[model samples]
Target: MEKVLSKKRLQIPQVVAALKHRNFRLFWGGQCISLIGTWMQNVAQSWLVLELTRSAFWLGVVSTFQFLPMTLFSLYAGTLIDRFPKKKMLIFTQAGLMTLAFILAVDTWMHTVKLWHVLILAVLLGVMNTFDMPARQAFMIELVGEADLMNAIVLNSSIFNAARVVGPSVSGLVIAKLGIALCFLINAVSFLPVITGIWLIRLPKPVQPASRRCQEGIWQGIKAGLDFVRKTPGIFVPLALLAVINVFAFNFNVLVPLYAKNVFHAGAKTYGFLMGANGFGAIIGSVILAIRSAHGPKMRSLFIAAAGVSIFELLLVPAKSYTLAYLLLGITGLWVITFTTNCNSLLQVQSPPNMRGRVMSIYTLVFGGLVPLGSFLSGSMAHAWGAPAALGLGALISLAFTVALVIWRPSLLKQEISFKWQD
Candidate 1:
């Protein structure tokens, strides 16, 4: 009995294995708290935009303003991330984000919140995020090294989805009782734990300064990153697929709110619950990946997940009831995290350590930078037809793209990834 118990205790699940690293544990805990507030703000912001404008086009415009900086400057931001210490840069970005949240909260509280105020603040928030996203992605490797890199990435996604599960649901209740201002205020305060966690992290060794070649010039660095992606088939293929999927299939921010109002004839609480349902599915998906972290990322799984997202999204077209929509969105959420998490791991594992930041910047660029265009497309489509039609069209486009990729490169499904780059 004693021997059996000892053996069982030694078998820690792969899902939580990344937390064994002290720095990663701190970072994970902090993010878990912070992301919930972020989601609350996200839910409130979308609903707030609708309350102010009641136009899907205007909602897209606000989203466009928020992500425009990333579209324009993410490549340049990547160079900066490569040239600096990620932790310090992250601290600065977090503080900037916190300040913006506070400003928005104050404006909303004072009833001086105009659409323009939200737009301008969103632009500032985008500026902060262009730097923060890639830095954060690149920093994961440093926290746990290559041995636990996949575990760390999946763990990060798990917490993010977990927050998605908690944040919007709670935000619905908060928004119903308090107001949208409180959500922003809570988000502003939530930054403290993450900032403190990053500050407390002690890397095993000092990170090296950027190579002279990397510091040559911002334009040159951007060119190099792009050139590298163009040449690497493994990295390039996933990115291309992600770009298509991101532009069409991932406009839930714009569509979900509209669905709640225009389709379901429901209000804020229903919208929050819908968003929460999607997050719940995402949490389940992340848990599945966490359990299978030992397998790392696979090309076949990536394609399948991409296809799954489109298929599930397409099913939403026939959903007439809130329960059916919620169920479909949950399933869609599952496929989304699986596809994105695999793409992220594939990019990081494939790139040389020196180029990881730039590679991830490209990832951030497509994943987020393109949100403006996607949001605009979805919003315009929703305005012209309806939320369901817009969503159905995007899903159709995404499914077509996935099919085209497989036809174009039948070999991609069988390609085995090599983790040859030294950490």
Candidate 2:
């Protein structure tokens, strides 16, 4: 009994091995604070757009504008991230985002803000994030080596979702009591922690290739990354699924706000709570992944999580009661996190050290790039058929795609991912 208890005690540290690394801890703490503010701005932005336009189509337009740059620039951004020091690059990107947030805040505070202003700022933010997302994703390896890579990724997801929970809840209160501008202002201020953290981070310099790749030009690097993905089934299959998910089923920003207002006749607080419910479920899923971080990927589990998300989302379409809809959304959140975390951890673990940045940029692109397209379609559907129809249709498409993939390539589902790409 004593031996068994000792083993159990020893397992605790293994679950949180990434936290032991000083650099990761600093980055994680600062990013946690900043991401909370980011989520606040996300809720506020959607609400602001909804208030101003009263058109689901316009709401989709705003989302499309904001994320378009990510699709266009992410491939190039990946090359730049690989060529530079990710730490310093992130500092610059964070500062740029902070500036954009401040401008939005001030404009709204002065009562001079317009829809066009928000749209243009969204474009700028998207451009900045094109650079930021890949750098941040790739930088994780430098903080904690391969042995703890999955743990670190899972922890990062937990932090992101934790912010998702707090940010939306707080933003709802602030929007109700204060104003929308304050949310952006608070988000602007929130960047200070992450910027300061980046400045203070100390790590051994990354080893450079004997000959720098940039000297030959970035296109070569981009081509190599593309080739790697095309040739590798392990990465290709998951990435293909991610793109489908993004295009058909990842329009939560557009769907949730519309549902709150149209279906429930609820205010910002209710919408915020619904968003918070999703985050809370995500937190639960993240914790589970963190605890089981050491385990290898289960092909069956991955497909099930994907299918689970679509099923719950479809069920939410017919849910008439607030409680039922909220519960379904939470379940959707849980499975979405599980599916996403699995994709991210698998990609990171599989890629070679030199290609990690470019690989992750592809990851970011698929994850975020297709969002604009999804948002636009979802909004159009909502405008014509209602929010429930839009969400249900998207979810159905995702489910169909998952089923088709499994049937077309059963080996893709059965093969165990060894977490390393073969050269």
Query: Model 2 lDDT vs. the true structure?
Result: 0.89
Over 4 Å off, model 2: 209-211, 421-423
Off by over 4 Å in 1: 1-11, 205-207, 210-215
TM-score for model 2? 0.97
- How much is 227 displaced in model 2, in angstroms? 0.7
Q: Give the true-structure RMSD of model 2.
A: 1.5
Report clash pairs, candidate 2.
none
For model 2 the local lDDT of residue 46 reads: 95
In order of listing, the candidates' clash counts read 0, 0
Tens digits of per-residue lDDT, candidate 1, 98-133, equal: 999999899999999999999999999999999999
